[model samples]
Target: MTGADDRGIEHGLPADGPSPSALARERRENAADVLASTLETRDATAFVHAGRGREPSIRYCCESMPHGRTAVAYDGTTDEWLVRSADASDGHPAADLAATLADRGPEGTILTPPHVPHDAALYLENAGFEVASTEAIARARATKTTGECDRIAVAQRAASAGIRRAASVLADAAIVDGRLAVEDGNGDTVPLTPARLRIAIDEAIVGAGAFPAGNTAVNPETVSHPDTDADREALRPDESIVLAATPRGPSGYYGGLVRTLVVDSDGGRERRVHVAVTQSFRSARSLLTAGSASVHTVAADLEAEVRSFGLDDSDEVEATVSGVGLESCEGPIDGSDEIEPGAVVRLDVAARVDETSRLRIADVVVVTDEGERPDRLAAPAHSLSPAALLER
Candidate 1:
């Protein structure tokens, strides 16, 4: 089967008029508009949740029609969802939509998200239309469709594979000059830097039929827990290394996973932190019951679990309960939003054991109906010992 990239170039389109990247972006925008327009037509309610400034909405309409839908053009100025109507002339889209609306007569009020543009809101108000803040769009997005959930699961599986590959490399790596070194394909030992591990992670995700969509961090010095970059830092023996991967599936859905491993450790503060994080992750997962709990409740419960581990609020511990879908961080389910059955959420926790040691773990879970437990997509064993991961 031809891959997405291969199909992009199969058309043999001219490269001068618009770069491939630009054309892809335009296609996405057009698709998003179409989605918004379709929804508006069905409900007669226009939603505004554009990107920055005068930019378009990134959620209500998506670039890819993985949900099997057509694309259209969205106009924020008139708070209109415009599509290529059968009677549309070869003129401005905004004008065409206005004419169409006039012919059909106004039906419902225009709804705007929290971050709608001021001018657009003003236009709707002056046109004698009531504009209200409705989280319906965001709430609808949080409840993933069956196809969306499947795509997320695929990405999560890919992310887990990538992290597992990194662990394999770490388990067999030789501590050379306080840095991890592994034998290359030609049987020559080479120092394994953050960059090299990152490449390995990306390759693993691709091998699993997905793309590395988010940040891939391989931190040798787990204590400092510095942001993963291209730095060629040495890997010390008996130290913890944090590996976090977020991969995107072919359907434009994302999944995330994070794990910490120690090489030949004597089971000290790092190990303690790992145990605490694992317990906290389990605790958070238990709270993802449909129609009963919200992410706000989960976040509070997770923090309490962390404190019960003898870590203070001031400790360098971070725990977040966020919804994950097309975007790595989607609509966070606060106190107002319930944990719906189809919601896909990520519980991420990171803590600094001491000045130079840290541990982190994350997992993606799908909320299910009553009598059914939440489904965990990434199933790698969360172990602190490198040998345990290697054995798998």
Candidate 2:
């Protein structure tokens, strides 16, 4: 919940605090304070138009539901703040005229604009909020406090658990009766159909005390049908399914996890190849404590480790290592040195299994400080067998 700090102004609490969204306004106010301080060094009135959240946070957090757009103007001259909006938060839309005309309803004179707050900067400009230049607000969000970092860690744990469980369900998996079948907790059969599987995994994530934000499936390269469009098609026996999910803790901080799997019957060479990939994942996890390793270092190290698997030439493998946070796939550290503290990153690596060409195996990681090693966030890497295990 929002509380007055020593400054005696109500402010948002960090992730470990009792309320996430309740404190969002406080956090935004702190950000505005930073803006104001910076503005004080210059000579311009700062007017900010913030969009509604997609979720349901009071101001903006995990709850991003946008209530159109809201405007906040800081008048340097008057030393006053003004808030305005077109939505109900400000005023309700006129009633529906068509419904009233048809006698089907009593509403009339609808006045809803397509997208509010959608053009905040433009709106501010129209209302006279001008500046010499625009700068990115990302810096304010980059580094994290100890509490924010802790909350991120918890979110990462939740995401990791979800991916690991999905991987288990893929092990020893096969297409049966137009559905990927697996044994469940009750020894009853479970179907791995796309939509059904998504629902089940989402339930698993929530059961672990987190929430799943999104799900998607893709196929590239194939064993049974490597060169054909079949590889890009839906799951069948011995195919790979990639699942990515973001989990949020009770606090609003978030982390990302991704899983790549190959359905197999006997788990022969395919299993060995997957096991090798898993080992590389473990190696990356071991290195995550590396302090200030640039995005480049993370990517290079992951590529090197994946090559350690020794399946094919570099041309045969494709993968990416990136940053994760409030938004999944934050960005690729690429080659910029220094990911800095408070940043959580996921290093990904993948490969195909010879002529079979099954694209299989992937993992999630976090970066953290480890003595001289740059701080990185990553989960413990584990091998994949041909069996699905339920994760708490």
Candidate 3:
């Protein structure tokens, strides 16, 4: 039965999408199927977990977690999850869960995630339940559910707002003495730097009701990563700025959007790199058709496409295409494995121009069923100038 999550925010999903309680029901049932398969394979009695959930909510149980940490199990027999409420003062998480399960019912082989604490496993063993680890839960989360997609789409709106805010700031700045500067509300002149730009972007994201933790990059050099102390430096004309928006929505789902822009350009190498990365985004987005290709193949194809434009990404860069969900990078596409449908992935393509210069464009995209093209999370397209891009 579906229950309320007092801790969960009412993200107000679209009318056609599942409600929070409905989505929670779908998640646990879907997770139960995977757990049942694992139980059959391992001949286990039930699956128990302790400590934190992979996601803030939507754990095996649907009730509001009253504890700092929660523990729940799946028996695959009932629609309900095996949950035992315990306080932190009682003991550690593993001890609490072990004690809770010990008194509840018969003890047998129990499965868990690989990272389950040693003490937790030991406590379970001491309590007469054999504990083993399985990758089933992780596997289940990789494929985006219908409700998860809708939640991510809500997050995407916030990301788009942040990107637009950042672009608007860059587009309105004036080139004074070769330095980019902007006027305050009082009409006082101030230098437009990454530090200033990040504040505007983050505020915009927060105003849109999303967490801006993942969208830290503002300078060209920090495109794919976090901000640096050097980001405090003043921006100069004709330099590329990578404005990224990777915010987490109220639903705990993440959204990603990145665009490289220049205040003014002499039509130099920055333009070439921008063009290359943009094409990489388009081509990589195409190759991520669900069931038609693997992310590994798409990354390789992206490399070749960027190479065709005389620009190349560094080995240090992450996989050009990777699944996104509760975490920013999910499933870590590293090998030749076919991507499943309903997988939401981030396409991050960057070209290295030197030690201090790089250009990148990234977007969150979802793979559709076979023979259909993938879809982008946001609508804005790439442009060399922030002004023209924001105008769209």
Candidate 4:
């Protein structure tokens, strides 16, 4: 099921004179060589420490150079890392970069980073270098190493602390005229806005030694507008609230968590939506295991469970199962790659309850070889009542 190009390091010139396909393959290889060399030079002094204080001097295969005009390249065959710096003494950085690469043998085809700036990519192509995507390098990083998992766990703890702090704020809030308000240290009742809640969550995350990398959404359930900005809304009594956080640890690994809370309510439609999402989340989590399932199969099972509750389809629900590590969302479950052991992933389920409100629940899970339930990172209770969250 793999092609010649897919066979890494196997591609080579044909026995006969190079055909167009063979020439293209050669170009790709040359490009890879250049990129690898560049990455080495950029990370020359880099060392990634593993868990338990073990340092493994590992280098990344692709990295952007600190200088804007030039990129680095690594030729695997020669084992040489070369830096192509722009001769900008004359003040033409782009032109200098182009000339530098042009003089270094055939430009062949160049592989660019996924998020490369458009101008940069265009410049390479204009300089006779065919531009290609570097997704393979990204896909290779989907499975987490032992050290990466440890980093992710640290971020998850920070994310949990943030959510818990926000929950505490909600629990002690007083409902005045249906709007939730909190008394300040001076005992003055102040209306709780979405911004205030977000501040509390962000502060908690930073206090726990993590960066608030993702948006903090504190949405009130009573608002019927789907696009209602959370920052502009006020928390209301007897309604559900959604709290979601993604915090990045010191190692730059991310952890995500989302939970729904309800004030003293009769547990009406909100409860039903919460139950459905929780079930779908569990179903999706169960499907993530090493070598047992693909992203597509997991997504299918999750969508099916959501539909069984008579909720909207996957499109409307925004159901997501994605790898979480360096990036908040990476290697979507629907990707062609199969789940691998040590892959940390997040299962996020959100369904609209009405025009004004939606219910969402998410948790990070780790794929293990044992085939048991994946390790849940954010182990806090999924749903909490106002009184329960208020408890010290």
Winning model by TM-score: 3
lDDT of 3 by residue, 33-70 (tens): 77888888888877777666544333534444335555
Clashes of each: 4, 35, 0, 13
Model 4 agreement with the true structure over 119-202: per-residue lDDT tens digits: 656666677766665544454456665556766787788888888888888888888988999987799999887778777888
What Cα-based lDDT does every candidate model obtain? 0.65, 0.48, 0.70, 0.62
lDDT of 2: 0.48
Superposed by TM-score, candidate 2 places the C-alpha of residue 93 at a distance from the truth, in angstroms, of 16
Residue 78 lDDT, candidate 3, scale 0-100: 46
For residues 271-363, write the lDDT of model 2, one tens digit per residue: 666666666665666666555666666666766666776665643655566655455555334567456555556656666665645544444
Candidate 1 Cα deviation (angstroms), residue 311: 2.3
lDDT of 1 by residue, 1-392 (tens): 21342222213422222343443344444444544665465453554443221122342353322111112334433543444322334543323433444455554565666665565456455555566665545666776666567667878888988988888888888988777798999999988776677778888987887777546777644323433443566566676778888876664567899888877788767767777888887777666642447777887777778768888767888788888876778865565566778788888888887777677888888888864778888658898766697566
- Candidate 4 displacement at residue 301 in angstroms: 1.8
Weakest 10 consecutive residues of candidate 4 by summed lDDT: 46-55
**Lowest summed-lDDT stretch of 10 residues in model 1?**
64-73
User: How far out, in Å, is residue 72 in model 1?
Assistant: 6.3
Write the number of the candidate with greater lDDT, choosing between 3 and 4.
3
Write the candidate numbers in order of decreasing lDDT: 3, 1, 4, 2
- How well does model 4 score by local distance difference test? 0.62
Clashing pairs in 3: none
